[model samples]
Target: MAQTTAVSSTHRLWIGAQAWALRRLSAFSRAPRTAPHLETGTRGEREALFHLRRLGYTIVAHRWRTPKLRGDVDLVAGHGHTLCIVEVKTRTRRDAVPAELAVDPDKQRILRRLARAYLHRLPPRAREAPVRFDVISIYLESSPTSTPAPSIQLNIELNQGAFGWA
Candidate 1:
């Protein structure tokens, strides 16, 4: 039993190391962010990581992409037996249309393709696990205060099974 536990712990550590390396490689390849929206998105993804962990989700990847694919998945997580392909949308303010609505039919199609690519790269066991599409909307609002530099408050919403493979 002790041997089994040690092997499990080592396996988990290896997976964590691989995920960290992937994130670092992605950051090195991506250009610097200057736009306000881009900055907001970066912050949103960071916040989303914490939010998902609080919900008992194990993050598998961040900014996952395939060389042949044109787009990237904002986050990939696992909850129970389900594999979650997460898309994150961030805005300075909530618009008339909900942020989740942005994952329209067109966007859903793209995500589906990306998910397929991601699954192909996974090991046989995980590749066959159930897959789910999730969307996380983050709205950043400035808190009303007397201070010159008002703090930003984040409103995060997680929509599990946001879309279907069909």
Candidate 2:
């Protein structure tokens, strides 16, 4: 016997979500609000971090804040002697732009600075370890109808000698 779930009587989601999104998009299309937009991104980032940990990375931070720049690195993890500073971007297939495309030059510069800050904050023994910058992009074929996991695609673009100079 297989487990079957009965459809709930009250299940109108898109109608509600569309209205919410429309209201949000309309209200701040001019000045732009940061808080609400981050809600969706945070969920995706957490999911990405989960997947990364499953594949053997030890997570160090989720959203490490800094005074100079206010942004997140999504997931920071370590593997063996290498300290991996990962930038996670998640997107659906419907979007023409891919997730990794989110990390632009400005974003890269900030991430680098944050990585340095993170290193600086670490204890002396940990700070001596090698640091690498990795960009992990997750593309999901996600929709309101799916109970199963998204068709997750990961593209890991790592700058091998990221902090070799320093």
Candidate 3:
């Protein structure tokens, strides 16, 4: 009888441990959805990263911002002999305005200033490399509900040397 009780206690402890582990795993796996704009931006950046990698650009920084600088660069990527400062714009089908239109002349000026700051901080080798401004626009479309997992179709456009230093 004592042996049976000991085995039952051990079994209960094992079950309890399993339940705890499962809870932790679920918490880890399930990331809460962010606000629509934030989610769109994150998804755009991710897609941009993949696209840049495929084109053989090494990513140097993401969302690079400094307290001294007034603006941020979405991505800093390096190709063979050039450095690219990228701005990422994401828009859902519901958005009336196109993504590229958002980067106006004012925004281009800010990006140029930020790029200067970024270059100043880089090592001599990278600083000496030619710099180009790029814009990556991603249009997102929601998938039909019949699919098991929610998905988005992305239409990406990469504009290289979209703007130049002033």
| Candidate whose TM-score is highest | 1
Please, what are the lDDT tens digits per residue for candidate 2 over residues 126-157? Answer: 89887777777655444454656444443333
Candidate lDDT scores, in order, read 0.82, 0.62, 0.77
Task: State, as a TM-score between 0 and 1, how close model 2 is to the true structure.
Answer: 0.62
Give the per-residue lDDT of model 1 (tens digit) for 1-166: 0001123545556655654575567556666667877777887887687667656678889999999988899999988778889999988888899999999999999999999999998888878898999999988888889999787787999888888999
Per-residue accuracy of model 3 over 1-166 as CA lDDT, tens digit each: 0001123445556555654575457446558867868966876787677666656677889999989868789999886678889999988774667787789999999998888888888888768888888898988887777879666677888888887887
Candidate 1 is scored at a TM of 0.79
Best model per lDDT? 1
For model 1, the superposed segments whose C-alpha errors exceed 4 Å read: 1-33
Q: Can you give the lDDT of residue 82 in candidate 2?
A: 76
Q: lDDT of model 2 at residue 143?
A: 48
TM-score of each: 0.79, 0.62, 0.74
Give the RMSD in angstroms, all C-alphas superposed, for model 2: 11.8
In angstroms, give how far residue 99 of model 3 lies from its true place.
1.2
Looking at model 2, residue 5 earns an lDDT score of 31
